[model samples]
Target chain A: MMHRIDAEALAYSYTSGQRVLDDVSTHVATGEVTGIIGPNGAGKSTLLQLLCGLLSPESGNVLLNKSPLEQYTDRERARLVAYMPQSVSPAFSLTVREVVALGRFPHLGPFGSLGTPDHEIVQDCLGQTETSHLATRDFLSLSGGERQRVLLASVLAQEPQLLLLDEPTSSLDLPHEAAFFRQLRTLSGRGLGIVVVTHDINMAAQFCDRLVLLGKDHRLVNQGGPSEVLQADILTDAYGSPLLVGEHPQTGGPFVTAPVGGI
Target chain B: MTLGNTRFLLLLGLVSCAVIFTCSIFIGTETLDLGQAWRELRSLTPLSEAPTLSILLMQRIPRTLAAFLAGGGLAVAGCAFQALLRNPLATPYTLGVASAGALGAWVAFLLADVTAAIPLLALLTSKQVMAFLFAGLDVFLVYLLAARRIHTSPAVLLLAGVTLGMLANAGIMFSRYLARPDRLVNMDRWLMGGVDVLGYQPVLLLAVGVIPCAAVLLLQAARYDQFAFGTTLAAGRGVNIGRLQTTTFFVGSLITAVIVSEVGPIGFVGLIIPHGVRLLTGPSHRLLMPLSIVAGGAFLCACDIVARRILPGETPIGIITTMVGGPVFLYLLVRRRFSDWNV
Candidate 1:
């Protein structure tokens, strides 16, 4: 399989002269769900932005399919990668279907007149994300979890080869969070590469094909299978607190817990 | 069912516009009966003794047409400004474009009167040039003041526009102070925004200026809709945000300039029509824009008719619209509190 994402010595700094990503380099394998977990301000979102080509890195380069990301045109980049931001406010009170149809913009001209195939693809995306029932509903009227699902449907409507999601389940309840991760797994199984940034380490341990831990200094500290990398010491060190790490009896995957201090 | 409801509303608006337009043509300073109006309209040859035909063709036709154009143009311009600034309260007057246009017309009027007396600058007898200069200068000031930062915040832009508008209003008041007592009445009538005094020349000029600008605004409806979906989403959808913003502002300001030049700052049409249409059409510019044009046209025509017949002589249509729009706007605010759709 082809390598979906290749980063080498990536570095980024905000205007505040604070570094968010420091010489970070990692590869995302095709058809795998790579989970990025870190404390707040660890540059997880910034790194995802750089990888998705939404923001150019201050140094180093990101390559997709062994080609420099800058080499692809805007439309080509959109067809190849879809980025779902962490927080967004819907400015217009559009229906869920209308918002999802915007994913076809790269394939459309300035007017965005959708063709027959575009309609079919949008319907398919809504179906995949289980948002078909909410297609005609007003987007602003939906609950937070429902809005997240609609946004995911919009991203899927692009039919992108690689998907980047930042805190996709941040607002979702436990059951919806599990269902969303399952949908991500199904997408990965279909040969689509996925990179998801999450605060939920336990969820990452359960579903992620590989877990990449980021330290507070915005550097990659560990990268391996969940069972190998999610040890109690590493979890405590990354979180800067006392924590417990155990195995799920049923799935045989790592499960992390924060324990009382001096444990 | 929703699509059917939308079509029905659009059809109703169109029919109302037609009826109002016809009534505006028939009822004026000198009323023309339907038979006389029809005969005058059907006649190809000019009747030497037909005073009614002459009056209809010369006075009412131009005034009615001006009302239609000004109403529709201002409403569309207002809708564009509201969408571009992302504020519900934005209008040509509030944004300073109308004030600027009024300044331009005032300068033209003063220059025309002065040039008529001075034989030296007789070559500059054309008042149209002065009007154009005033509008151009006003829009330039608005753009410069509101565009300091690369990231155009709608609130800041609107604040700048309003500040400039107040400055222009001050300039107009200064001009009024300088004017002789006799010209004050004429200036008052112009400021009140009556349709009675306009001729076909200014009406044709307004049509020339506004139609192309409105067409450009209509074509950008989808881009505006994406913009309404927020700046980042618009960019993600492949829109060049800077370019879209510049184009929308330019076109919107151009239409506002033209309407202000002809009608002298009719209020409330721009502020109310777009929001009202959004409530009916669900905030999509695809439907809101066309509906705004139709509803604006009808609303203004109806206002003008009421202005003519409400008393013996014609009152300014602005008075009628403001009086009506204020209560309706309040009612809408109350209704919005109960409704789920807050656009």
Candidate 2:
């Protein structure tokens, strides 16, 4: 029942030889939320992509369930790990229900239509992400927050053990952001491994069980509990700016904020 | 679009195609009524006496079938190409296969006298054979130009294709300049596009080339749906991007080559049928491929009917499709459903 993905000492560069990620390592485990938090150009999105096998690391390897990530076929890996990018703009028209139903394609038998059970699972995913109301609407017609929730429902329909998301809540308003984190916790409670990349350090502090913080130089700066990683000195060093860390008035968790000009 | 309507629309399209196919046989200028034609078909009367029946059995039937196959195949190929490139305007024509085919046929026409004198030119004797060969060459050249970057940038593939298309167009112009006047008229007529064959030979040729490739495109229907968002997202959903791209491009090109070689690169059907079908049904490829296939066949058959009956002498099918399909496509474009059109 314990599922984990371990990425070890991964390095990567684009077509140009300049490396974006170097000697970076992290892990995501079931029943816990892992957050990759960083400043701009910190390779957070690239790391998430590497973790989910979207991009192969130039040097180093990823292990899923103690087996090499490259060993799994596309369908096999898809059944285990689902990934959601920062945004989705479909060039073709599809309704919310249809897009969510697409996640079941890996599990279906060859030339199989969705059975009653598959439909039920799709319906359940829509409900879980609070996107049931938008199930019949065109995916392109929804607002950013609504589309994000619908996408979450769609990925959840894959029934993946490990879910990796890149900045899933970046465009969401405050209430929508809070609602999304609550949805993540509920999934984590049900023994799913959820890894999210985001710029919202305060939300990450509140929601993440483990934080992997990357600095501007695209190197891991800190990796630990929210209380340890959200410290003023650590935050200031990683983000390359002056920052203040305090306690949340409501949840009493770590709260990260920045000074407007100076302090 | 919902999954439920995919089957419904396909059935509707099939019935429409069937109706159009049957009506096309009746509407042509052949003098025989259906009753007399049926009697002639049943009886052992020689075709020498049954003039109307001969026209019906020999000319219209085969010609109508060829139109159906060419239209359906081109539309399916274009649909696959569009989805593969994620561009609405993409077709095999965009990739230079049609232009190369046109040049190949023109070259064959120009070299007709030289084919017997030179052994090597003997193999390229028929326009169909030469057209297919040059289309394959065009595909190979475009592949060579775009293969490395195609994974990261599909625009490179389109650029290579467009460049090749321009070169092939130049080749066609040079060949036309070299051709004799009689050959020029023949070449021009072929260029204009027609399904005026009198027997089953052309129909059989198109069937041999089209049926299997279009079947492959149909099999890849769901993968096309996954690709609508882009390659990375498609890969995340368990599609093998390499395999899908290969199948979409190669199979689509092969279908276009087959159709273009046989029918002289008929335009508008490949470019518009899929979009027109998307307007009627939604954008699901499962619905799009088969519906496009049937609707494309029907559209061409209707156009061919007009081509045959509207004038004292027959008009080219290409002209009718463009003349009719252009206004209809624009009407569909300006109409209600395209508000969701992204590609």
Leading candidate by lDDT: 2
Docking class of 2: medium
Off by over 4 Å in 1: A1-19, A22-30, A56-76, A114-116, A210-213, A219-246, B1-3, B33-50, B94-97, B100-168, B179-182, B332-343
Candidate 2 wrongly placed segments (more than 4 Å): A109-112, A259-263, B1-8, B33-54, B93-97, B111-167, B328-338
Interface RMSD of 2: 1.7
Report lDDT (CA) for all predictions. 0.78, 0.82
Query: How many Å off is the CA of A94 in candidate 1?
Result: 4.0
Candidate 1 residue-wise lDDT, B48-147, digit = tens: 5566777777777788788888888888888887776666666776677777777767766667676777765644434344544555566666667555
Measured by TM-score, how close is model 2 to the native structure? 0.89
**What is the DockQ score of candidate 1, to 2 decimals?**
0.31
Best by DockQ: 2
lDDT of 1 at B140: 67
